[model samples]
Target: MAPPVEPDALPSPFAGLPGALWLYRFDAAGRAHVLDATQCGIDAVHAPDHWHWLHLDLSDARSAQVAAKLPLPDDARATLLSPDSHVNLQLDEDEAVHGAFVDWAHQRGVDLAVEGQLRGDDGIGWLHFALTPDLLVTARRQALRSVEAARRAVGAGTRADSPVRMLELIAGRFADTVERSGDGLSVRLDRIEDRVLADSIGEERRDLAQLRHQTVRLHRPLTAMRRVLKQFEQRHPAYPEHELLPAVARLNQRFDDLDGDVATLQERARLLQDEVAAKLAERTNRHLYVLSMVTALLLPPSLVAGLFGMNLPGLPFAHSTHGLAFALLLGVASSVVVYLALRRMGVSRST
Candidate 1:
């Protein structure tokens, strides 16, 4: 029997090697057992029937050192260590599959009380994985929702009979997060729509713009992931016989559907923004028209008062004892006439 893991000698799971986070060995029956670094001997890992998984935090220097010693293929090693690696999947000539994927990371302080409501902004991160028939390695620079969910599932005795199944589970977790985000976005859009209908659009334009940006961010990464999965389905050596191929294909389709939904939502937001602008312009034009009519009505009275106020030698109203009354009457008559003319011309009609 193997020696028991000693708490004093083992490093803390959260703060060890630059990127070494967790390790596990899963047997043929889909049961997982946590393994210490000291237990991951090369001879044991190389056993034809052995299956193991190592999760590392790539931001740690010790993780890089540990990764360099692993039996990963050259391409997989390079991809794992490269900081600029993007979301992609490549099948190496040695039958190894490796790639990076974008995953959602919940922001700190976000309120999770509501089922689909996310506070602040949605966070995004990357997860890299290298897979062989007998081994699976995963690395990340930051914590990811999907990875954590998979870990929790494993601990709960979820069946992951092979490395490929593990990958599928992780992918499915990502899909779930995206789906939830979409649902949240839909709820937000519905509220915005109500505001738009009521003509109470205040800061909703900014809100819609933010939603559009988030959708675009989500769409791009999902598109890349779908393309990678499609390529894997068509070209990877383990195509038809690979039990996980169908799962991969399903994931690809789901992302495609999500891409379409996001695109539609984005377009709807843009349309709503346009409508708000047009309504504002129309309202402004009506206000300006009303102001111009008021100015016209007051023009005649102002001119009349100015003429009478002047100290001209022979002013008609100046010689009359009832000059003030006569002037007031004239101004009122002029204003009424102007108002009538405006109404007749249809300038006062509501749009």
Candidate 2:
């Protein structure tokens, strides 16, 4: 398990404002400046070309109260405050883009990911945001690694000309996270494939099944996200001098490539699972065939012994001491004949 995010992990720009984590303002020239939370007031005034970005911590009790103050459409506000964890995006009637994006959680005290391994749920986080022409608002209940990456990019002097562009930057970081995870999953599948091909799979069927499920987990959401983006493109056809068109295309391309990789992994894992099942079935059939042969060879001896030990009035065997030897000899002879017959019938089989 990972430790929860510390309150001080994100520098609080609005000291007196509950739920406000960090705020930024960009001038017409696209220079980003850290701002106080007071600037987010509904009645606050700013220059015509000035835009603001306000990030809130939804874990705080007053986050909904703070979100209510933003001058945004009702749906956009609802999206920002939505608790749904699935990957989603919507271009509303008012043209406000809002969605929840999947991301890697930022762990403070421990590192759950060891080299090429992913620890599943320990690494998943969702970043929710709303974007319009000017203002961009992002909120999260847990700390997201994309937030740190975005902060670093801004600190390194990457200029976001618009709120949509900033959203792109954060989303690109998330895509990178997905790509990295896909690579890890690929590595794991490679090892699993090797094991499946080189060993008896009767024992490994469980692990192979789990790998297929994990691959599907990644594949499903990516497919859904791709569908969402395609819907966006259908609604707003691209033309010349459009920032969003190109941005959406680029984002979609990244996700599409990721989805392709995950899909391939999914197919490969499934094939390996099938191969494992085939091998296991073959083994089971071989064991059953051996058992049947043993049973056939023992059947004649069992019948001979049953007759010799019968409590009937046939006095021929009860009168002579040599009768015991004769009965044992008969049992051995019958067993030998049955063995010879079985050998002639052969153990050859079609796989």
Candidate 3:
């Protein structure tokens, strides 16, 4: 076995790698094992037909060790020690390594993306890697609260029968993340709905905009995870023929459930958006109605005022002692007539 590095070791040759993850490989007995690499002692640990499961912290050498555990193509072996920016790019350094990892993932039917930000907002996506008779690799980009809790459980040696159980644990964390997010989303949606109803246009607009952006941001990684689980369910890799299938199948089911929850959330957000828009439109219509009434009430009085204010000697009502009263009466009558006309025309009160 290669010597273990201390946690505080000042950056391995693999340091500063974006999306860095630590990978731990375990044998069928749940004991640690190493992957294959052409580098000196690395090739010796992974002989022909050995199977292992790997646990990875996305920001450490955990992935490097797992890569070494694979029965890599020559190119993959070559890229193992040669540091690069992305883990996926390892295959670019050698077609064989690319083919081996790609084919292996394809055979196992894992829609795994080793690098790239999982949209940055849904936290990081995670998967536990397992090859029944060959290998297992679990990976994530950053420490998620749920993932950390699961990791503690694993480290405490709580019941992880095989890699499949660990997968369930990881999936459990993902489920919790979704649940927590759902709770938060529900609160926000409730508040927004209240605002929308309160007829506060500015506040309602901001809330709706925020809700839409948040929903879209949160939806991306979960959608990707559903695809990953679907991929996992369809592929069959060499593993212990005894019981791994059922475990993986169950995990796939959980993934489906998670997908359903995400879809439900998306639908709710859409409904909220439509409601907000309709309410805003209603408010706008009310304002427009009020303005129209005010303009109508002012039009006749304005004309009368203009005509009487003219300095012509014979202006109508200029010389009458009741001029002000008559003008007042005319204005009142004009307003009454206009109001009746509007009522007859089906105009509703707005303010």
Candidate 4:
């Protein structure tokens, strides 16, 4: 299992805060520069020619204080501060675009341990965003894969010249995360299929169920995001002709395809579970049938022995010197008759 995340062991950037914060500024040439949040003033964010992206971790108490000081519209501010916000997108009265998206918090092989420790918000997290023409602010209560991806991209000098474009890049990151998850699930399903074909299912049912659950969880958020993206496309205040619009449309379609794939995989897992159950039942029935046939073959012999052993005085061959031998021969003959009769009627054949 992975070691626990110690409170005091966080990296420098996230130290001494309930959550981490990062600031990025874009220059006229579309180059990105990482800035310290403590050093950036409100005037820098409001400059007409400058574009900035701010990411805040809302899990910390101080994040509330930091968020209160930003020049955000009321609805956008509410979204960032509301703990119960769900996956959605909307335009505030001031034309600021605000939305929430779902992301995998503890991705397998990223920070998740092999022994299944380090539970992460039931395998999902929420990221809320408030976007205007020049500024983009994102808030989350937990670590998100897409948010990390955007941070890495910006760190590598990728340009995000507008808030809309920044949102698109983050959405693209989300799509990428889902695509990779789907690919991994496909591999798992292939293994499960092989096990089913070989009739070697042992604990695969539980594994498939787990995979199906994860898929369902992922599907819900992606479906919500798809609807939100559709609404955003229709009502976006940014340039109606922005290239990011088409890109977002395509991204939404990709999410739809991924969601369909997850559904198919879930169905396949369910069928395999049923198949395993049926095979087990068939095996049990065959064993019981064999036992029943054995009992039927022995029934006649048992009856013959029981009758000859009775103490009746007029029983056939009861007083003869060779009575014992006669009775033994009779029992054998009766058993043979029963066995032959059963074979003739195909009662001994396996179904």
Candidate 5:
């Protein structure tokens, strides 16, 4: 047997590489064993039939150093250390696959570009990864939710003999989080629809707006991911022979379905938004109708008061002893006449 592993040893060739976070190895029997810390050389770790995975934090200052020390192909290494957040997968001439993917993550002072997070509104993070036959490497500026969940699953003895399989597992975990979010949106839609039917959308316009925004955020990245994966599959179907096709196909199908669901939610929100606008317009029209009727009724009385208040020499009520009473009666009669005319014309009738 090999010597007992040291807990404090770092994956070596470069001393004190702080970016390295987690390391795992699969033996010839294909079981995952967490290598807490290792001083092992990359070549020694990659001997004959073993598979290894190293996860790193690119937010750390040693990102370049760690990428340089990786045994991955140059293109794969570049992908792992790239600070740009755009998603793409490329197959290197050496048969390594590398890409950046959008992943959900909580924020904590990451030293990376803005696009890496979930549109800067949600905690969406980018996961940059590269995979070879015997090794898988993933680096990210911020901590990702799916990456951590995959670690948990591995701790629970999840078996993935290949880097492709591990990648699939991490993607599946991400889909699980997305499914929960979609289900929540559906539930919220049901409540919104109920309120719409009951005519009690007190603050639901604003709520629905937030829902639509979240759906858009989820939709845009998912679309780019699905589109790029499909394009990669169609164009470069031969390289990475054993694993790439099925993995891309599976991810494409899963994300396509998810993108469809988000699109549906967006459509539903649009329709509800229109309905809310119509409802608000109808309410405004009713209030305006009431106000116009009140104004029409008061118009004649206002005219009578204005005419009486003008201090002209030959004002009709000015010489009468009962001038004040006559003026008051005239104003009341004018208002009543206006009210009767409006009633007769059906202007006061409820719709």
Candidate 6:
């Protein structure tokens, strides 16, 4: 009997983050016995390559790092180990990683897309179509649970035996990411709503800015993926000796759903941004009203003092002790009148 394999040696990458691999045995009815890649199996590691197998992760650094460990054919050796493979070749200190990934994909005939979003404190990911006739690869930098789930499904051999299945697996991943993003956003928005209405929460301007940045980053990949998905929908490539129409149709539905979810999130984010702006405006107006009321209140007292301080012998309230009390009363009465006027006008100017 073969010796037992260690967990680290598993064929599926990112083993700890809930990943799995599935291989399907074919029969007349379609896929027969499905083999889980994580389990010890006759066709696990060192097994021959089969069409439509999927391996992906939301935390790209770990999975991509491990994929580099996969043994490459001699012909592909030079390309596999090159620095370009580790860090996207097209990038420099000034360029973005996603931009470089796109350029590389275009050069290699691999269709790819990515979407990233930040709503409040939550991060969202939606990546699609990083596979080609030769290989399929997708990555999201953050920790996403759905990527792990899809990897588990594929490891368990639930996917079909065609490139289209690989596409579906990827599209399904984006759908999962979209759903998760929505859930997270909903939770955060709920918190913000509570704080906005209940507690005197400080401005969320910085939070809004962070969210905008995350959404923009996510939009880059999603927009790119949308293009690639459209290509799959229209061109309908043939590979792995199987029909891909069903898979492609399913992919279309998934893509539509993902797009809709992203749109909703963007709209929600904008609405929040607008609310923040309105609140800020209201705050500014309130402050101005308070300042104006204070100036009005001070005006009467300052005028009375100025009149009595005139060193002229005949100044009206200068010599009399009664005059000082009368002037004090005048100032007090003037402040009361201003305060009442402001109150009637709905100004919160009182300290």
lDDT of each: 0.78, 0.76, 0.52, 0.75, 0.81, 0.49
- Clash count in backbone of candidate 5: 1
lDDT of 6 by residue, 62-124 (tens): 444434543433223233223332212111122111111221111122112233322344434
TM-score versus the correct structure, for each prediction: 0.85, 0.78, 0.63, 0.79, 0.84, 0.55
lDDT of 6: 0.49
Model 1 Cα lDDT, one tens digit per residue, 141-204: 8777778778878988998888888988998878876778778888899899899899997898
Worst 10 residues of 1 by lDDT: 110-119
- Looking at model 4, the pairs that clash are 18-60
Candidate 4: tens digits of C-alpha lDDT, residues 56-98: 8887777776566577887888887787656777765566877
Prediction 4 global C-alpha lDDT: 0.75
TM value for model 2 = 0.78
Evaluate residue 320 in candidate 4 and report its C-alpha lDDT on the 0 to 100 scale.
94
Prediction 1 global C-alpha lDDT: 0.78
Order of quality (lDDT):
5, 1, 2, 4, 3, 6
Residue 55 error for model 6, in Å?
Answer: 7.5
Predicted candidate 6, C-alpha RMSD: 11.4
Best by TM-score: 1
Off by over 4 Å in 6: 1-151, 156-159, 194-203, 236-242, 332-351
Cα lDDT tens digits for candidate 5, 1-351: 988888546444455445778888887666788775435444444657789888888877775776676778887888888888888888877778899888888555643232232333556789999999888899998888778778878877888888889998898877776766787888889899899889886898998999898888788878888989889988885664668778988999999999899899999999998998889888889999989988988888899999989988898879889999998899889989988888899988857
Candidate 5 ranges with C-alpha deviation above 4 Å: 1-18, 28-30, 108-121, 239-241, 310-329, 343-351
Each candidate structure's count of clashing pairs: 2, 0, 25, 1, 1, 18
Which candidate, 3 or 6, would have the higher TM-score against the true structure?
Answer: 3
Q: Which ten residues in a row have the lowest lDDT in candidate 6?
A: 96-105
What candidate 2 gets wrong by more than 4 Å, as runs, is 1-16, 25-51, 71-75, 83-96, 104-118, 123-126, 152-161, 238-240, 311-328, 343-351
Q: Which ranges in model 3 have alpha carbons more than 4 Å from their true place?
A: 1-147, 191-202, 235-244, 348-351
